[model samples]
Target: MAGTLTVWKFDSPTGADTAITTLEDLQKQELITVLDAAVVSWPADKKKPKTHQLNNVTGAGALGGTFWGLLFGILFFIPLIGAAVGAAVGALTGAMTDVGIDNDFIAQVKDKVTPGTSALFVLTTDATIDRVHEEFRGQSAELISTNLSHEQESQLREVFAD
Candidate 1:
């Protein structure tokens, strides 16, 4: 099966960063394939979160750029300094709907991952969920949302929407 878009939330940015590292390690071990990953770290001072997307550095090239560019475009309304890139990203965002990610999911992540917290957005396949869960033992991280199912998504929305 194709990978799913998943968001993992942590109480602290450090925790989220650690989780990303662990995910990378898993990928190295051939336990999972990380298509693309992004981390959002909200400063304690309540400034705009710093976002680091791995797609740019991982050779995802244009497709990766378009995905993250469109995402940040939606989250921050980043002025599409260039009309061509902006148009391409906009169209890509629409095309991504078939993959189970949409503006609503992005909006939810933006709204829920508040100041002083962090979130890791991952597109992955061949994940060993049980092993991953075991790896996260004792962590306060929560699986906030995913392209899993409607009932689960609704439950997550209810829990974090407040």
Candidate 2:
């Protein structure tokens, strides 16, 4: 069905929270997707900050914890095939924990978020973009959507496209 899609990019967590609350309130009348996302923030005047590690396995103690859990699981059911199953589980868990820039489009945004420039993206369908924008006009967020002019629609399509 034809519906409106509204996107708002917030500057920080506070702005994101406010937008999320507003969108959720509107959800009583429409559908919304407040995707949970995070980016490194840094001061623009200073040099850019490096990407912080997000690997759950490689990080200190995380892999060890995974292995420890597997060991416990295996020991608890020694007579059964728990050892082999637990080993497989632990290996799969560790392999899945690698944090790589899987999506090129999102990676661009990841690279831009410095030590003080986080962004939160909220997408809502069949909602009034103007109402949402008016509610969050003062905050450091820009509302971009196809609800605007043809040019804006095309721009938004490209930005949100695969």
Candidate 3:
């Protein structure tokens, strides 16, 4: 099945958290199917960001770790050493590329989502954008990136731009 991966940035961690909850509600209502979701929150006092994934299945957990690890590595420009780390990175990169999410997008998200802020990364199927926008009306959030067509991305930007 085709899926869209999107990153929504918020000025405050609380806004991101609320948006995640809204996404959960949409999933429950069958408006969207959330395959995977993660939140990156950077607290003011913390030196590093905290990432939390929606699903905690063992297999999914390891994949999620690779995803976040690569992200953090890119974000901080950490050089990967050892064959195991290199191999894992290579594998994850290929997997993400196949899914239409490239390293560039991840880097962009890492750059934009800063300390005291948060971002929600969602992989979803059958999303009702209009209804989701309505649910988020009057809320503050930025559509950072998505594996969506130009027109669709524009529509989403306009929806949240207000």
Candidate 4:
């Protein structure tokens, strides 16, 4: 099955990490399959969030470091560069579009995930949506799907091919 890039934002700094336990449980239950997973935890006192790849669940399908680094860097770092480097910003935008992500999605994530907030970034497939949703009914998480375009899919394949 084709993988979907999805993110879920939680109110607390530890929320995303806490959710990982549940995610592992669900995966074992055969309710969902994960390609790769990572957690972003941002404490109130921190300047920025920290990331950790879930290596145990990540098998052959994993996109690993480069994919997540570029994405999180775009979401959390690029803005600091601002228009001073207009060409770089434009190139960054182009790079994002090459992976089938748009400005709207980037803006949305930037808006929702802030200091004291945590997010779970997941590349997943074969999920029983209803069951998964039911399991997560307790926490308030904003779900965002990248919904990779055909072009994005092709680019991702090329990225993994190397």
Per-model CA lDDT versus the true structure? 0.66, 0.38, 0.66, 0.80
Residue-by-residue lDDT tens digits, candidate 2, 10-36: 555345445545555655555333221
Q: How many backbone clashes does candidate 3 have?
A: 0
lDDT of 3 by residue, 46-137 (tens): 66677777673112532354555555565543453546577766765665555455778767886788888887777666889899778766
Clash pairs, candidate 4, are none
lDDT: worst 10-residue window of model 2? 50-59
The residue pairs that clash in candidate 3, if any, are none
User: Candidate 4, residue 79: CA error in Å?
Assistant: 2.8
Return the lDDT, model 3, position 84: 54
Every candidate's CA RMSD: 8.4, 15.6, 8.4, 2.4
Q: What TM-scores do the predictions have?
A: 0.70, 0.36, 0.70, 0.86
Model 2 residue runs over 4 Å out of place are: 2-7, 29-112, 144-162
Candidate with the greatest lDDT versus the true structure: 4
Tens-place lDDT per residue, model 1, 96-118, is 55445666876777777878888
Cα lDDT for residue 44, candidate 1 = 77
Tell me how candidate 1 scores on lDDT. Answer: 0.66
lDDT of 2: 0.38
Error of 3 at 31 (Å): 1.2
Question: Model 4 Cα RMSD, Å?
Answer: 2.4
Best by TM-score: 4
User: In angstroms, how far off is 106's CA in candidate 3?
Assistant: 2.1
